[model samples]
Target: MEKSRGMLPRLFFFVSRPVRGTRGPARSTHVGAAGAFMSGGAGKRTAGPGRQGSRSALASVRAGAARVELERDDEMNCETRDSGVVAAGRAMTVLLDPGTGGAEANYPTRPITLVLGAAPGSGADILARALLPDIAAEVGQRLAIDYQPGASGNIGAARVARARPDGHTVLLSTRSASLHKVMYPYMDYDFARDLKPIAMVATMPIVVVMGNHVAANDMLDAMELARFNPGRYVCASVGVGTTNHVLCEILQASAGMRMQHIPYQSSAAALNDVVAGLVDFLFTPLSAALPHIKSRRVCAVAVTSQLRIDEIPDVPTIEEIGFSEAGADDWYALMAPTGTAPRIVARLNRALNAVLANRDVRQRLARLGYMAPG
Candidate 1:
């Protein structure tokens, strides 16, 4: 005699029956049964096959319960937590499919809102626009990007933090995610505390440019400009607490270099002063400094990255010049307020990665100084 695999479903169904002197009809069917199944009456049972069916029935019930418990939280994936088998029916894959909630096919029910902390003309805002188009297409809903600039994005971040947990709203910001705790220690909500990590965005490198006349003849020469000159050297930055400010502080603390930290109202003002040698040094991103470097207005002394930057291969890195740790830069990434459904996160990750794969989107982002990808 041979056993039929078709009988497995029957066996699984029979296993759910109780064997304690239980009796019931064999055929049972229910419509729209996702986890719970239709079964015959529970009555008298025998000690042989009836007992086995009853045990299998109990196993099925436990399986469904375990599946729900494993993926309903902030953990990475189903495999990490629930010892639950990796299958569509049992596992939770958020951000991978918009119509994941028991739909016949993954489809989004509403538009998604991506909130950014930068101003309208800022680099972050531009990057958001560049990335949003393709992603919005994939998810089948128009993406509405809302920029909330005050408090460096605290206002908009707070909005998402309090939004519904159904994954409609997202937060996009730079490395400031981690520093937000430090930047606004007294704020009502903390970044990492209130938001969940989605995916890391591209990293923008900062360049170390210098004036022609101030070329450090030697290490002693550079140190002289840093230490001996002291307050005579004024450092200009687009604003306080940006990568520029961090780099300026690192240099001051590491080499005993002292300079006046002047916060500019805008990047243009700081660039102009640096070009005219009105400011001793200015810390800016490659995108902002590229124009000055090409126009012979500013010199790129070194790139902040640990290696030589491809855009400006002629420039050296800070580490190469015996400065072991005086480099600082910014990296951007996607985040959602805590408690957003994991399924939604997985869906968004898939959509965003698909958009990034497009050749035109990739090239345009590179042109924007994101270095291809981070």
Candidate 2:
């Protein structure tokens, strides 16, 4: 007889009544019963005719129970598979959906604050103000400037670090942001851990300017005078622990010279003293020193960059004068409080890059003695 699909021939055992002390040999009985039913397929079975009738009823009961269990297992597996697909779909949607994943999608729900770590008219402040209009338009929000100048920009940076990490408040910081932690080890907040760098806006070389009273004609002469006069001459910086102050120290050490360091509250004050002949010399930002240099109020001796600045090509770099180790440059960048959403940081970076890419903006920055980094 042909076997039925999804059926297996089950074997059953039976024995004749055992004789007195001896057991009769067991006889094998076979019955055709349906095997575990599988989806889209069936099993085969075979059996002898002699015992088929005897064990068919018993085999049918066991086979029926197994079939029910297999069917239940198949249903459970299908449900689990479907649930896995749904869960994966939900995760993909969350990752790809701008409303959910993109923090920049609806950012700056309120007016944004751009914090400058320097006084008004300082290099950082000027750069921040210059880029504000363009960044504001790109972000589609009204932007406000907040000046928190103190501790060589540490005060302003700490304020931003303590602010909520919601992208509403950001900082326009300079190299002082990194220098302050080392210069003032007792500070309350950590610079590296608290601030996140968004993008570098512009960089300008620090120029070494001397008051008109100084007899030095160039950097070589100035160093010679400082080496011999030592404490007789004085050097001014915008503030203690600032890039200017540090650069002056480096220059002194490299040249084996000594000069009095006068720290002013702002670059304007320092530059004012330099031009007025109160301070012998100052290491200041190009932006702050350009106007005075042009007016011949303060003589531009040398720049601290590797290359000469285009605005004042006549002024050679420190390296050109053989003081290669004294080269220093100042830079301004946008930063947010640590833990600000990455999407927001990316958005701000894009806006800054766009602003710096404009030809007119580049020209304006160039006139201020600032250059966009390559």
Candidate 3:
């Protein structure tokens, strides 16, 4: 596997939040102002005019960090952005404590913990593992990976949101982290209100795959077979309301067909079931399914990206197959607790971009079927 290298270009930064009715990958919006100054009173200061200095300090720190990230981005020539994946220019949110102005010089006083919302061998996990050694070298500390997978990423996200707002602890999350609010409304933490976006990671397309035993040659054939036997085929997803599950729903809605939906706790488990023929087909991330597809354990029916992936050249895209609504990509990101100091956020962002700039890292991510900006 070490010899396997991707032929795709490089990936940069694009941090974005999900919006209603938006198509393609999510877009980045500046949340610096909202996070820069503490929000208690609306446009009014309750603690007299002394708070003005703190606000000003926050602004200065944010500006400095943004400049650093910009310089690093320019050094890497990070102009090429992939539409299928989220990329960003300025990836840090500004939130600073007036007293911690010089503390960033000594950031990551201890080992850092990168929390993953999915199980091992998942796309996000693969990304984190690939980047950890370089990131640890940049931050001058050992990086530890803590997996807290469950509840469609809500479990791990909530844990990160509640962690101390220090650089030592951060979350490496995916699109599912953004969707938990709507899927599990009764959750403990509010993702948008609690966590801060640090930097954009890699993005890969979702794929429609089937076991070898299935009688379908391609996506169109699979859909036709399902149409002939409605509700006879089973579709699998990591969990209900996950990006993959949503893709399953979209495929069915756009194709005007039905398949039994099976939800699992992890992408590996769901995909394993698909390979074992327990489940008929599945909508999964390319990172998880790539090895299986290469091994011929399962057949890729279609991809949910706007373009075809080099890893699987023969597989048709959902758009070409007339299921445009089902075409979408998944992204990974670095995030921290909301109150983390702006300088720390900026430091991490710089480290993340630096890692992405590495040729080996980019190639490894590409092998996972992630698209590079053209």
Candidate 4:
């Protein structure tokens, strides 16, 4: 495993947290505020907002190190923005304007770094790497993987936050990875505030499962219990700021119920405890839950996708029961530091999209429960 890259010189930017729902990628970053967490108050702070803007926001590992700062736009290297717009808390679907040449020609003159926020065996990590070679071909540069998985992807994200704006450094993250904003109040970084959404590689669904103890027949049955019991029950999340937690939040809001939360860094940990009757239920990736669901070790409660899944078509959707939450196929998008040249971002998006469109590549990703972007 790669040890931390130590402290990066701090480089801050004008972080913006767009409250709008995701349209098509690109939005501002957020610096979450501080919180006390489980013991008493809110959890960690968001990474951006509450953040003081400067080009150099680096936090050196050992401290007392001089920091590196970034300069405001030089005006000479400016590029146009994607046309996607934000409407009333929702993001608009937008596409990149294909670049003809210039940057594309010089792209990848050096080895490129692909920063993965999820763990090694995670679906997000799998999807990003599947497209890596194809992406490298497009840029004519050797691409590389710089895995920085930790603190619910925040550690890796923070690394990206301080990377050179030159676009050589790219972060691999997903919607589930992006849920840290509202879930934790003490996060030090925000997806919308620190990174630029380059392209959405693929999206998978989030599923809800019950522990051995639930004893409920279906979602409605459990709903009745949760409604009656309120805070008596609990839900499990992979981490503090994960879609698992967000799904729980959405469920609570819609069902008019409250289920306390228990957080773990990985699904394996949460699933093990949940199965052992240590924790309660969890809303996690289908990729991780399939094994348990097949063995009947855990109960499949609801799916968060818009439609049914081929693997488990009959599973009820959160919507069928009269609510919609963050259950859309969870997606992983490639992001570069904000201020990364628009040219480079477009080049990477195009190359990666090309890979997603490949037949063989599609099949490989399918096995991982990843569906390429249209």
Candidate 5:
């Protein structure tokens, strides 16, 4: 039940039975089966004594659905949209009940491909590696990670968007992908139209790190230098439209400075350049920059969060340095191709939530500077 805490209230599944006089493959309107099984917010259903209990549960579900519909219009930000429940569940009608001999009971007929938009050492990749072992155990199959890092995660996103929707291929998306619409107007694939939201898994803050050779000691000093000598300094990002790039833009805007923006295919490569002093600085996840910061290869100028993190307690937050506008947290979510079956999505959601519930898994994420949702 704890594993299903934040998931079941929004995810709905239906068991279809033939009505007495209905024609075609139309399902019964009873709603009892779904309510009875999903009660108590548990992933599995328990048998109820009568239909009365089911009816009451159905009413609650409908009410929740209506509230979600209303909230959908209010979700104007990228992070809010990523965590939306009912709006993402417009396709819930296709959710088949596993109790009725549906294919969801025996899902993952083959190995699943988890497509990541960044390289192996990136935040998305780190979270995936931390959780995949437990998720694979729950789902009864291996989840092969396919890294296609490039174009600020667009290349990997496009591959998953076009992949077959049988649930065998899913994208491990980040908040960065959601901004692609504004960043690249003419992108080949539509993120909202082409991808299905499964669940928002975790979130973490970005760190502003600089190479050892940089003349400045902190973010304010670096900004002053860049402000005085325009375009003399350089910053790097995974790609132009990524969260890294967006944060870079925010820092420059907030400080009223200019620095050349260099884009890379992966965070590891970008951080490497920063370490080698080929680039002056970059905005990266703490997990990616923590090692370098520890080794003193790169100095953590500031964190993009309201408060400082324990791992880097000495580093001040951007807000602490008077750049409140630049403070933001990065998040990760699971998504499949648009047409992926709802039943399959439900199965994956259950598996994912179960993995997130483990205390060890939560601790591992904490060490990586990520917080898993309850």
Candidate 6:
């Protein structure tokens, strides 16, 4: 129920587009000559030929309102009135005027791209899709959900980080996004530097489930089994450096046990292997592992939340098993590239708060074992 506070300004690259063939009063200014300045507008005409004859030329320069547009064809591009600016043979540009006002006034001139860092049907993906309708309705803009799954969500996150900070492209990510820096030191982008946290969406407890082949009935039993026969048991996680993987590591450290770590690319694959007894146990989202537990395909050991969840009240928590420090919750949040405009971030935070405040949205999220932010 905690809310995000304050607003942080993001970086923006301004591109000046002059009206073609429209001449106005001449204005002189001293600045760097880099890109092609088209004819027209209120600016002093530089000594350059018209657009038809020259391959590259500097047009009149003026300090006017800044506009940003998204280029869908390429991953991302930064356009500035500096060196090496190419105006010819470029994609269509949709101008975003930041000086207009708040996000409600001048944002989302186009469809917003909601990037999911996980595979389809995964917990993160499901949550992102579920919240789309309500968010789109509140924002008056359709959200285009894009899936970029790989490297435990780093690939998708990287794309968002490199995207234009026009609030059109944002990412819906989990805690795993923050853990990537420590896990993968050679990564191209830094999560904290490239991605800005907008607002928290929901939080859920991770359930510990064991296959039928395991004799452990509870977390205590699982710890004992691992202690007695070290390395005989293996735990499966959605991927390396994920929340579930970290939870397993916490459990191992807290319980003084050793087990082989098995990482899978997707939750479905990890769950399937766990059900087949190929992997002894798994710590996964309740929504993904609940059906298996109910069908008797996997034994519920314990949840990683500090308190028992309503969806599976019978499943004890890690704190209840005398390992309070091992408790961890899986959380999802809205994020944009660090350079996104402040008004856009504020607008997104407001819209998300409105959607989360909806009674029906809360009920739907609760049914999926997710706790909506207050």
Q: How many residue pairs clash (N, CA or C atoms closer than 3 angstroms) in each of the candidate models, in the order given? A: 26, 1, 5, 49, 1, 3
Error of 2 at 204 (Å): 1.3
**lDDT against true structure, model 2:** 0.64
Q: Looking at candidate 4, what is the lDDT of residue 214?
A: 81
> Which residue ranges in model 1 land beyond 4 Å of their true spot?
1-111, 150-156, 164-166, 211-223, 265-269, 276-278, 372-374
Candidate 2, 182-293: lDDT as tens digits: 4566988776667776666777778999988889888778888877764667777787656676567555644556567667767799888887777888988889888989
Q: Which one is best on lDDT?
A: 5
* Per-residue lDDT over 1-374 for candidate 1, one digit per residue giving the tens place of the 0 to 100 score: 01111100101111111112111122211111112211223223223223344345344554653121112222222112111112213322222333443222444678888887655545566667877778789888888888776554567777777777666788776543344444555878765457765654555667766655566743335546656554555666545555555555544444555556665544556677777777656776666677777787877777666567666777876656555345544556677777766566666665666676677877777776663331
lDDT, each prediction: 0.54, 0.64, 0.64, 0.58, 0.65, 0.64
Assess candidate 4 and give its lDDT.
Answer: 0.58
CA RMSD per model (angstroms): 25.2, 35.7, 15.7, 14.0, 19.0, 22.4
Model 3 clash count equals: 5
The TM-score that candidate 4 achieves is 0.67
- Stretches of candidate 5 exceeding 4 Å from the true structure: 1-103
Give the TM-score of each candidate. 0.64, 0.72, 0.73, 0.67, 0.73, 0.71
Collision pairs in model 6: 1-374, 11-339, 37-59
lDDT of 3 at 176: 64
Candidate 3 lDDT over residue span 1-374, tens digit each: 12112221121111122212211122312112111211111222132222344345334544543111111122121222211111223332222233433337678889999998889887778778878999899778999999998777888899998999987889987766665554565888877678876666766788888988789888778877866665567777776556677667545544545566766777789778777778888888898889999999999989877688888989988777765545667766678887887778767766777777788778877887774221
Pairs that collide in candidate 5 are 37-45
